[model samples]
Target chain A: MTAQPTQTGKIIISVDAMGGDSGPGVVVAGIAKSAKKNPEVGFLLHGPKDVLSKLVSKRRVLDGRVVFRDCPDVVTMQDKPSQVVRSGKNTSMWSALESVRQGEAHGAVSCGNTGALMALSMMRLRKLPGVNRPAIAILWPSRNPQGFNVMLDVGADVRADAKDLLQFALMGASYARNGMELTRPRIGLLNVGTEEHKGRAELKEAHALITDFADQANFDFVGFVEGSDIPGDKADVIVTDGFTGNVAIKTGEGTASLIGDLLREAFKYSPLSRLASVLAITSLQRLKKRIDPRRVNGGVFLGLNGTVIKSHGGADATGVSAAIKLAFTLAKSGFAEKLAARVASTAELEQDAAQSALQTK
Target chain B: MTAQPTQTGKIIISVDAMGGDSGPGVVVAGIAKSAKKNPEVGFLLHGPKDVLSKLVSKRRVLDGRVVFRDCPDVVTMQDKPSQVVRSGKNTSMWSALESVRQGEAHGAVSCGNTGALMALSMMRLRKLPGVNRPAIAILWPSRNPQGFNVMLDVGADVRADAKDLLQFALMGASYARNGMELTRPRIGLLNVGTEEHKGRAELKEAHALITDFADQANFDFVGFVEGSDIPGDKADVIVTDGFTGNVAIKTGEGTASLIGDLLREAFKYSPLSRLASVLAITSLQRLKKRIDPRRVNGGVFLGLNGTVIKSHGGADATGVSAAIKLAFTLAKSGFAEKLAARVASTAELEQDAAQSALQTK
Candidate 1:
């Protein structure tokens, strides 16, 4: 592994090697692989130094791109978010996130428990100015050629009100613009229906708020959407409460896999089906690669002061490596800063609107 | 189609033929196939009389097992639940559900808009005693050889409190016991972690409430269970709020499909993988058939007065027919009455416990 220089000095991705289901072994391996591919990049692998060193010795590696930050403890999935952040001072996830916050690294990526990661990042780097609550922005494959669909507030706020939802929409819009390079991203609130009266009372209220903003702003707010509309390119950015958002993403992933399994089983039952599968195998593979959730390993936790990437807890080397690369891209794009600026101005605008309404009354 | 006699009186499954993505054509074909296997059953095919009659004419006879009820309008997937229920007076889905509610039919099934069905059911039949909200319960294949995993609150009660969750757990347990014939079914509350304090504050509180009731004479209440544990046979019944439950189920479905597709592609890419796929194909199909969501399409909306099953909105004929079968089973088994009695007693017991605790304090 060799260090590769980015135009902006150096692109360093701090890896929480001790995080995720497989621990530092896969994370370390992924970083090793990623480092070898990108010569100008460097990694600050935060974990137990001795263990990582032992693991690294078993594999082939040059040196400069790899380094270790000693973190004595690791955050378990079962631990409370506060406990993991406050009590586990020497945890790998915490240290890696801290490295990015303190500007020692350009960005950080963790395939750990999402709850703990969100809490620790908030407590360390903190939320950006005018951001009520940071959101977990995930890129899901839409039925369009434009890469993927970005949804936010996946596991950030459980009991979200109208205001929280509005903030989520704004944050997601900024991420789409800055990270995915989409201008005036069409934002849709994932509800039971597209009508104003379709969703819960909170959603209706949120719709009223965001619609007002969209009337004035550059962003395209496309009313409301349902669970089925997620796969379609109805909107580039989808926003919802963490609970619904999390379930929607998971459901889509689960259903897609289930259907694929069904198709495979059907194909195997007869010679004719098998012949058809053989013919369509290339196109099928391409579609699978495109829709694979593992390919989009890291989800940006939007509205934070610094870059906080949440990788899949069950990620393998390939997935974790993709997350590292994603974090590098997000950091370079300055998505966090863009979000902070937008949110700050939006909050001011909302306040002015409220004031005017009150004075007129 | 012919109606035959059973010990529990002649039960009819009224299916809305003009529902789902593929329409009544697939539904009629599926029902025809199912009816051939079970001649003792009866069906009331509700939709546009002309369209349904034309489709039915193409299918083989089931010895008078099939009938028809006319409905004028069809509800689209995008229609709001409330609006559809209110205005769709003569819709295929509405008429079928009404037949069940009015006791003209024992059960009804539709591959219609889910929100519309839920709204219509709640509006007509109303909630059961001691149950604030109704839950849609689906059976997923478990590692246990006995039956499938009973998951409740898939899309009912989005803003559920701890009390609401407790009600759902009890309802799910009762349904599992009566419908699935699992006595003393172990109930697990779905959370992010297995630990008591892992999830949101509400979940933590709900865990305490459930644990407190575990030692009582009701169903065996297990502690917290994670998303991954649901697939395993850790608990017979799993309960969560509608938002999380729906997502988890969807995620499970999608992820499963994704894995199968990946395997299919891999097998096609090489000779060795193809051989392995060939060897395991039969066993895999059997397993998949057992776990298919479409096969378990009829999810009972427990905590509602009378029997109302929510078939998946995107359900095909097989799924709709299965839902119809599920509804009949519930009706004949007298599950609604038994659950109502049990829940009434449980409510009384809870009130008594609260009174005693206050005296002690």
Candidate 2:
């Protein structure tokens, strides 16, 4: 590949332009809005040239910051992830990920098929050392000062063993350090109860594993956390299987929508009620923005070869653009490589600890 | 058993009055109200005589319809299930379950420790012929006229085999027939996706196993359902493991709370909006009442020799009262016997089907 435009110290984001429900139109619009404010950032659009050209022409101001590669094929949301990723190498999702793998872009963002992208990335880009399964780690709004907590394995691995969970904690910790700029993130396993022996066999095994690692000063591994702690933001990183994560996220989304409807009804009682509601509107709006899934639409698939961010398929232009910016920030953070190195070095600590225990016995 | 209190189609519900958050006060109150509405129902309150006497005195009007039996210890919410049930044979939860198992009561209700209740009931009542584990089946409110969909194995078997899921479906089908008054209930397996090849190994194996059963005329078993379908009431019975069920229910509860909060905020806009809200208040309240989980707090643990229902630990007086009424209704419903009979009758179908398939091959 020829030399692409560099943005000095700013992050370069390669986005799958022809992804999501509205395709490149929303993505391009979102990027246009984001690029105006973040001038230091650059975007590489991967999609059909004709579709993106029309959308780009409408937004004249986004000219310098954005560029495109005419990728013909687009991965549909319903497509079997493995089948398409293996055969359709020239698809927008694949092309965007290729940019990151080849070091042509700092990060890649897609609002298309998540499963396909993850499967493809894992097959193409080797997993991080000790990471049996790479996970989709995302930020969730919390009551904490950190704005939100990070959760992992949202849609990557359905059934995770002890080793997989350990890797999730590691990858999540790394993402928190880089993505959220946490110096040392507190990690916790999502369990039924807070007690040490309160979970299933896999969770129990995972707890012992993480605790053993924590003894070695590998990372800040906290104890088990309950389902209630997820929204409470008690831990910096919450690790769980993709099945549970998907359910939890969807439940949050559905519940948020339901509550919004309730609040609307509560304010319509009387004139005084309306006045009280008006007073609370700004504060409530701020809270809404905080918990809004759209605002935090982007998530990073950690333990992959490169920075691969997945945006919500239903995102509007604003959401798509925020995702692009988030991807750039994550890629430039240098957290992935740092995390890989940290994991590699600390792996021997576990082996050494096992040996010590045997000798002591 | 003291001449078996009115054996003429009268359902006798024996409740551990000391089981719930509100204790016998709420249970007695609920029984009083329900007895007034349905005189055919009889009640047996199992707990300490002194404690239950005070509660019964408060509802003295229904004294003729209810009787009190003395039992001592209570299973605390945090107790280890298996150990508690094994040791505490004369506890309130155990006595309540035993009353049903011994034919002294048709059904039993408890708002006490779920794990303890499940363990005690499973041990005391025993599983049906093919059922290795009993499942706690709950009714989740959906948008359909069927009122709600049933989710099973909510906390019975944490690590389930293919046989466990099929048995769950069979038990759930029987419940739908007896409790729901449907001749043949539509059953669906709770899974990530509908594809036969999707989900975990357990799900795949279960899916393949159920196909044989579904082919016969026992019940209409629909293939698979996602999380969204739980709220949609698309099927009569939805089957999943204890781990997934616990997470899904927690997510639903959390989501419902979030939605209730959102609706409270939505109507606080302006003066004209307040009047619009007034017009919509009745409809909204109607909607809230429909989705309120408190209405259906009691869940039956199916596939047991006796009928046992688990109420939420945090259930208040109204919620506790509902559980008592539900227990009484289910006792008369003859669900347990019908399920046992149905499974026994279908025993030959599987063997015959296998033989026929072999012959054809």
**A1-361, model 1: which lDDT tens digit per residue?**
1222323466888888876998788987888778777766777888889998887776665265667889899898777787786697889988988787777777789988788898998898888777777888888876545868888777776667777888888888878887778888898887754656554787877777787777555789998876655655678888888766765665455456545555677667677557656655665567678777778888888877778788899899889888887887776786656667777877888666444544553
Q: Which candidate tops TM-score?
A: 2
Q: Candidate 1 lDDT (Cα, whole model)?
A: 0.74
**lDDT per residue, candidate 2, B1-361, as tens digits?**
2216544556788787775676667777777776777778777788889988877777756766667778888777777887786787778888888778778788888888887888888788888776677888898776456777788877666667777787788888888777777777888887776766677887876776676787564678788877766765467888888777766777677656644554455555555445544655665676677677888888889887878888787777667667767776666676677777777777567556545544553
Q: Measured against the native two-chain assembly using Cα atoms, what DockQ does each of the candidate structures obtain, in the order listed?
A: 0.19, 0.24
Q: What share of the true interface contacts does each candidate keep?
A: 0.14, 0.18
